[model samples]
Target: MYFVYDIGGTFIKFALMENNGNIKMKDKFPTTAKSAEELVAQMVEKFLPYKKAVKGIAVSCPGVVDSEKGVIYQGGSLLFMHEKNLAEMLARECHVPVVLQNDAKSAALAELWLGVAKDVHSATILTLGSGVGGGIIMDGKLQSGYHLMAGEVSYMESDFDTEKLRGEFFGRTGSAVELIKRIATKKNLTDKKDGEQVFALIAHGDEEANAIFNDYIYGLAVQILNIQYLIDPEIIAIGGGISAQPIVVERLNEAVAQIKAANPFHAAKPNIVTCRFQNDANLYGALYNFFIQFADEVI
Candidate 1:
C-alpha cells in the first residue's frame, strides 16, 4: 500500500491506495495549523498506525515547490515560507520513500491517467475555485517549466481593467475567492458558503449576480484563449468546486464561442470537458505519482 496526500490552504486530504490504484482508505481535515512542523506532526500521528503497510508517500501541495529537491519554495495561500524538506521529513518519520508535486500538476496527471485526458497526448486543466489554478501536459507528460511553475494560468493578465479590478474589485490577491466575495458583498447576499451558491443565485435571475458571473466568465475566457494560443492542447479540462455548476460551464462555453467567433483560427477549437474526479483528483494523482516513482519497490 502507498499513501497519497493533497494539501490545500484550507484542508488536507489523504488516501491509502493499493498497487492497482484502488483507495483502501481516505480522510480529510483542516490544513491550517501553527506551522509546517505542527502539520507534519499531526499527519504522522494520524498515519502511524498504517506505517508498516505503506511503502511510500506522494504529496500534492499548493505553492512554489522544488519537487526535485523536495522542498517548498513558497506556500502561496498557506503562508508557509520557511524551507521545509517535506520528503526527508516524511521519510525519516514514516520510514518510507516520498514524492512531491504541485497540486495543479497532480490534478492534471489524474486527468491524464484516469479522467478526461486519458486519451489525449497534450492537454491543459483549469481548476476554477478559490483561485484559478492550472496545469499543462505536453506529449503525454506533465510540463513543469524552467522553475516548476509553468502551468500557473491565474497570473496571466487579460486587460488593464482586470489588473485594476484585481485588488479594488476583488481583493488583495485578486483571486477567484476575492471575486466571489466581492460579488456576494455587492449583492447584499448572506450565507455564501461556496461558489455554487453564487451560481445558484445567478440562475434565479439575480441581476447583480448575473453581472458578476458575466465578468468572471469573460476573464476566464480570456485566460483560456491565452492558454489555447500558447500550448494548443488537444483538450482543456475544467476542475474545482465551481466547475460542478452546469450553468458555469454553459456560460463558459458561451464565452469561448464568442472568442472563437471574434478570431477565426485554422486549428480546431479544443474540446472543453469537466473533470471526472472532482475534488479528489489531486489525491489520486499523488498516488499515481508515487507509483510512477517507486514502482519497483511497491510490489
Candidate 2:
C-alpha cells in the first residue's frame, strides 16, 4: 500500500492507495496549517495511524517544485511553503521515504498513464481552479523545462502594459474563481462563490450572464489557441470543479471556432477535451509519481 496526498490551498486530500491505482481509504480536511511546520505536523498526525501499513508517501502540491531535490520554490497561496523541502521535512517525522511533485505535473502524469492522454504521445492539461494550473507532455514523457516551469501556463500574460505591473495574467483571468467572482459582482449576487447559481444563469441563456460568459470564454479560448500554436499537442484537457458544468467545453469550442473564422489564415485548431479524472486526479498522479521515484523498493 502507498500513502498519496494532494495538497491544496484550502484542503489537503490524502488517500491510502494500492500500487495499481485503487484507493483503499481516502479522506480530506480543511488546510488550516499556517506554516510549513504546521503543515508537516498536520500530515504526520493524520498519516501516523497508517504509517505501519504503507511503503512510502507521495505528495502533489501547487507551485514550482524541485522534484529531484524535494524543494518548493513558489507555493501559490501557501506563502510559507517557499524554500521548504516538504518531502525531507515529512520523511524525518514519519521515517518513510517521501517524494514531492508539482500538482499540475502530477496530474499530467496520471493522465498520461491511465487517463485521457494515455494513448497520445503529446498532450496538455489545464486545471482551472483557484488559479489556472497545468502541465505539458510530449514524446510520451512529462516535460519540465530547464527552469522547471514548462507547464506554468498561469503566468502567461493575457494582456501586457508598460505602465503598470500588468497583472492581467492567465492565472488570474482564466481561472474559474475569477469568472464566478466577475459574474457574481456584476449580478450583485449575495454569495460571490455560488458557482451553481452562476452556471444556472448561463444555462438558461440569461443575456447579462451570457455577456460576461462570452468574454470569459473568449479569453480562455484565445489562451488555449495560443497553447495550440505553441506545442500543437494532440489534445488539451480541461479539468477543474467548473469543468463539471458540461457547458464550459462546449462553449470553449464555439469560441475557438469564432477565433479561427476571424483570423482567416487558419491552422489546425486545438482538439480540446475534458479531463477524465477531475478532483481525484492528483491523488492518482501522486501515487504514480511515488512508484516511479521508488521503483526499486515498490512492487
Candidate 3:
C-alpha cells in the first residue's frame, strides 16, 4: 500500500490505498504547525503508524507545485512551505519514494483516472469551499498552464466591482464561506456558524436565508458560465464540502438555467455534475500520482 496525503491549510488528510483506488485506512488531523520543521515532524508521526506497510508517499499540496522537482514555489495558505523541497524533505524523514502534485491538478487526475471523468474526453472540477479552486482536463490531459497556474480559478475576477478589493477575488465572491457569511449577517447570528448551519436556515425557507442562498448560487453560476465560455469542456464537476449538500447542486442548476435563458448568444450548455469522490478526491488522486510515477514497478 502507498500513503497519500492531501495537505490543506487547516488540515492534513492522509490515507493508505492500493493502486486500484481502494482505500484501506484513512484519517485526518488538524494542521496546527506553521513552520516547515513542525510540519515535517507532524507528517513523520503520521507515517510512523503505518510505516512498514507503506511503500511510497504521495502528496497533494496547495501551491504552485513543481512536481518534477518535488518543490513548491508558492504555498497557498501555508506560507512556510514556499520554496521548500517537500517531497525530498519528507522522503528523507520517512525513508520512502515521494511524489508531489498540486491539489487542484490532483483532483482532476482522480476524476480522469477513476472517478466521474474517467469516461469523458475532457472535464473540469470547480471546488467551492473557503475559496474557488479548480482543475482542468483537456484532450485527456491535465492543463498545468505555462506558469503551472492553469486551474487557479480562485484568482479569477468577477465582472462586478465587489472583487476589486485586495484579496477579494472570485473565490471570496463565489464560495461557501461567502454564502454562510451572508446568511449569518442577514440572520443576525452572533456566534460564527459554518455552512451547514446556514444551509439549515435556508432549508427552513427563511426569507433572508433564501435570498442570500439564491445570490450565492447565482454568483457560482456566473463563474461556471465563464468557465464554459473559456475552456468549453465536455463536463464540469462541482466539488467541495458544500457540494455534498443535495440542495447545492439543485440550486446551482436552477441558477444556470436562469443565466442561460437570459443570454441568447450562449448556446452551449456545459454538462455539470457533482463530484463523486467528495472529500477523499485528493487522497485518491494522490495515490494515482504515486501509481503513475512508479508504473514500471509492481506494488
Highest lDDT model number: 2
Which ten-residue region of model 1 has the weakest summed lDDT?
166-175
Clashes of each: 0, 0, 0
Global local distance difference test of model 3? 0.85
- lDDT values of the candidates? 0.77, 0.89, 0.85
Please give each candidate's TM-score.
Answer: 0.89, 0.96, 0.92
Which 10 consecutive positions of candidate 3 have the poorest summed lDDT?
A: 159-168
Q: Write the per-residue lDDT of candidate 3 for residues 15-122, one digit (tens) a residue.
A: 888867788988889989889889989988989989999889999988898887899987989989999999999999999999999987888888878888888888
lDDT of 1: 0.77
After aligning candidate 1 to the native by TM-score, how far in Å is the CA of 105 from where it should be? 0.9
Candidate 1 lDDT, 71-137, residue by residue in tens? 8777777666357888888888888888888888888888987888878878899887676778888
Could you tell me how far off, in angstroms, the CA of residue 207 lies in candidate 1 after the best superposition? Answer: 2.4
Return whichever of 2 and 3 wins on TM-score.
2
Write model 2 residue lDDT over 1-299, tens digit each, in one string.
88888999889999999878899999998999999999999999889999999889899998799888889988877989999999999999999889999998988888887899989969999989878888898988888899999999988996788789675889888889988988988899999999999999999988888999999889999999889989999999998888888999999999999989998987867998998888899998888878777777545
